[model samples]
Target: MKIGELARRTGLSASRIRFYEASGLIEARRLGNGYRDYPEDAVQRLEVITCGQQAGFSLEEMRALTLEPTGGANRHERLLASLKGKVVEIEAMQARLAQSRTHLLALIAGIEGKPVDISCEENAQRLLARLRENDEPHSQAT
Candidate 1:
């Protein structure tokens, strides 16, 4: 089909499809009239490409997984390393979220008990320290 039809069917822009083609994430054949012809499968391929991107896979990573066998090159190692890094990142974020929740609860309790501003500040500092300590292990693991 034509580029416009492909874009409409895939819910992507024509330029985006063209860019994906140029980036080697997608392929198209040139017709005798110099227009690009795409298979019906191109839409599904583009969908997979975009979904992989949203899942934090880089173009090169997506290409390796979808386009060909990885052949046990550094690509596999790199993917593993990247996944480890993401795991560490997620753990750290969770630590921060827990800290924020703790701090918020403390603040609410202090307000309900009519505590002084200085007490709230001290409680907040303690919560922050706990968060830092919790995140330390994740950081060191990375």
Candidate 2:
């Protein structure tokens, strides 16, 4: 199939297909007339690339996920392992984000609870103290 047909079938632009080729995530052959020719299985490969990207895989990671390497079992194992690893990474990121959010909310509370008559410099000092306290070993929120 030509790039146009591939793009139509995959719902991707021609430039995107060309970019995948440039990134080494997909391959195309130059025909006698110099137009890029894709194999029938290119549709499946492009779908895998898109799916992997949607799941937060980098183009480098998608290359591994989409490549048709020799030894079918190795390919299957690699895919499964990569998926599990990605899940773990996402969980860790979620936890860190949650912790940071909690710390920010606490800081907001401290600032809001300050006395209305206090000078700005006094409020700043109070916030610095709160920060130092939060940064202690047992109280560290993030």
Instruction: Identify the leading candidate in terms of lDDT.
Output: 2
lDDT per residue (tens digit) for residues 3-105 in model 2: 9999999999999999999998878999999999999989998998898889989998887667666568888898889999999999999999998898888
Report the C-alpha displacement of residue 6, candidate 1, in angstroms. 0.6
Model 2 weakest lDDT span, ten residues long: 63-72
For candidate 1, the 10 contiguous residues with the lowest summed lDDT are 109-118
Per-model C-alpha lDDT, please? 0.80, 0.88
lDDT, candidate 1, residue 10?
A: 92
C-alpha positional error of residue 133 in candidate 2 after TM-score superposition, expressed in Å = 1.8
Which residue pairs come into collision in candidate 2? none
Please report how far candidate 2 places residue 15 from its true position, in Å: 1.1
Best by TM-score: 2
